[model samples]
Target: MSAIIRTENLTYTYSPDTPFEKTAVNDVCLEVEDGELVGIIGHTGSGKSTLIQHLNGLIRPTSGRVIIDGQDIWEKGVNLRDIRFKVGIVFQYPEYQIFEETVFKDIAYGPKNMGLDEKQVGERVRETAALIGLDSALLEKSPFELSGGQKRRVAIAGVMAMRPKVLILDEPTAGLDPGGREQVLEEIREYHRRSGSTVLLVSHSMEDVARFATKILVMNHGSVFCYDTPPNVFMRADEIAEMGLSVPQITRVFSLLRKKGIDIRGDVYTVDFALKTINEYIASKGSAREDGHD
Candidate 1:
């Protein structure tokens, strides 16, 4: 598939030319293919937020280019509004952005703004609400009355209603209980599977990313530290850890076993892979003991 989102030497600085000037994203370049689910992870203040904002033309880069669908988003005659519609962003704590009285209206907001007729907007809202697992019974109730998780789901549904070709979610599962987190992540994964939209998910949890992301993008100090498939990226566990990021728990477990002189592979990154490795090790040991006895 072609690259749906690409950035070239993208740089953004706050308060340029002032003592407070600081580069939030510095000379970063990356590409996201059509329908690919990418996980972006980094320490706080590592420019993960800054970089995504550029993709949708929400923020102008101090230098460099952000190309969406083979077009430079910032180029003259380009409609930034159109870019925003193509790339939907559900930011961190998106629940705070919900202002409509009812969940239906809140989710309808984006579709409404796109000039969809009443019937079309209603259809879009209901379809997205269902996709996000929001109950139809809650559609007319005030969003504020809903629990925090439900509020967040409503917020996500709003973006989904827009039918963006590329969906970017920043910290979608943050500030949720474990079950709630899992629910939201599953909803997102399902949405991606059903919609075939290129998705960018910013997350802090290595386990969560490892479980779902087709690829991982690691950032450090406003620069791209690493970008690769989950297994390949996690294989550089030591390099990632040095960048102030943690590897998945399963990867760390295998690494610990290897360090303690166990004959095990340290490259395992997922629980399923770890279990398979353990079984293989056991099988090999059993075969060795049988041969020795013979």
Candidate 2:
């Protein structure tokens, strides 16, 4: 897998040279492989948002470079709009950005902006609506008339309609009910699997990341804390706790169980993983007991 997105010494400062001057992101370097589902996590004010803004040239880097598909996005004479089309970003609570009268047109907005024909735009609108679990009937209603969860899905569909090479979402499941959250997260996972597009999910939910992400990028104080697979990153529970962040609850439980000499896997995060680990451990225990009795 080649690197589709790379940042070299990326840095961004807010209100530079002023009394309120602050460095939001600092000298961060990273590489996201093509077709990877990467999760970004950090505490508030840890520069998660600032770091992503630089990916598609939403925010010009104060220093360093952002390279996408082997081209520097900040290169002079580069078309920013084209870059945006290739890297779509859905901000947190993206529903607020929806203004079109009907859901169909709202979802079609991005495809239309790309100068796609009506047929192409309509196809993308319908396809993406389905991908995000929006029914065809909802496309006829006003975006504002839908429920909060529906509106969020519409906003997400709008971006997905573009079929960008890379999709970035910031806290996409925020403020949704438990069922809505699960539905949205599962839909996103399916979308990534079906589209084979690079997906960067900025989330605070360790469980979500643990279940879906192939890689995890942890940030702290505007710098890359670590970028590793879910198992490896969650293994450093102590360090994550020190940064005011936490691993999945199941991960913490298993870690404690390991500390107690339970001889169980400490890296389990999701419920499924924990259950499998426990079942295997129990089976092994029973087998050992039977052998001792023999």
Candidate 3:
């Protein structure tokens, strides 16, 4: 299948032609296949946010091209606004963008901007609100009056109401408690599953990315460091650590266990996989003991 989005040697520089100018992205080429969940990780100022912004034409690359669905998003006369509707971006603390009086209105904002009919806007709002686990009764209440988590949901629902083919979330779970983080991540996963939309999650949490992302992209020094599956990327734990990043906690634990001569696999990044491996090891040990007795 063709990539939903592709970049050709994409490069971006901030404050070009000025003494303080610096390149934020450099010769980075990547692709996002349709309906795939891609995780983006990097230290601060690694250009992750800048790169994603180019996906939907929010930032025009200083050089190279960003193509969405086989067309250059920055082509002259291309409707960038329409592109945004198809490629929704939920920024960090998106709730702060909420300006509507009611939760329903806040959620409906995107579709309304798209000139959707009243009935369609209302339907989209309610459907997306439900998807984000927003209570129906709360839809009538002022968004400003809702709790932090609820307001965050309203912001996410606003993006969902646009029915984007690709959703890019920058730290979608930021500033939330553990439970709230899980809630938001689960909701985002469900939305991706139900809609089959491509998801680009930019997060600093290795654990969350390992749990949810199908592919991982690691960036450093404003360039692509690696692009692969979680296990493949996390396998270079020491290198990742040196770069001011970390592998998932389970991966780290298994790595330590292997170092301690426990015969455990170091590549296991998820809790389920770790448990299965440990169980198989125990079973093997039990069989060895029985044979010794025999």
lDDT agreement of model 3 with the native = 0.90
CA lDDT of each candidate? 0.92, 0.93, 0.90
Model 1: lDDT to the true structure: 0.92
- Greater lDDT among 1 and 3 belongs to 1
Better of 2 and 3 by TM-score: 2
Candidate numbers, best lDDT first, in rank order:
2, 1, 3
Query: Each prediction's Cα RMSD?
Result: 1.3, 1.6, 1.9
The digit string of per-residue lDDT tens for model 2 on 1-294 reads 789999999999999989999999999999999999999999889999999889889899999999999999989999999999999999999999999999999999999999999999999999999989999999999999999999999999999999999999999999999999999999999999999999999998887788999999999999999999988888887689778887888888888887888887666778988899899999999999999999
Q: Which of the numbered candidates is closest to the native, going by highest lDDT?
A: 2
Cα miss at 131, model 1 (Å)? 1.1
Q: What local lDDT score does residue 119 receive in model 1, on the 0 to 100 scale?
A: 98
| Residue ranges of candidate 3 with Cα displaced over 4 Å | 261-263, 284-294
Question: How many angstroms is residue 116 displaced in model 3 relative to the true structure, after the best TM-score fit?
Answer: 1.4
Q: Give me the displacement of residue 106 in model 2, in angstroms.
A: 1.2
Query: How does candidate 2 score on lDDT?
Result: 0.93
Clashes of each: 0, 0, 0
Model 2: how far residue 230 lies from native, Å: 0.6
CA shift of 26, model 1, Å: 1.2
Ranking 1 against 2 by TM-score, winner: 1
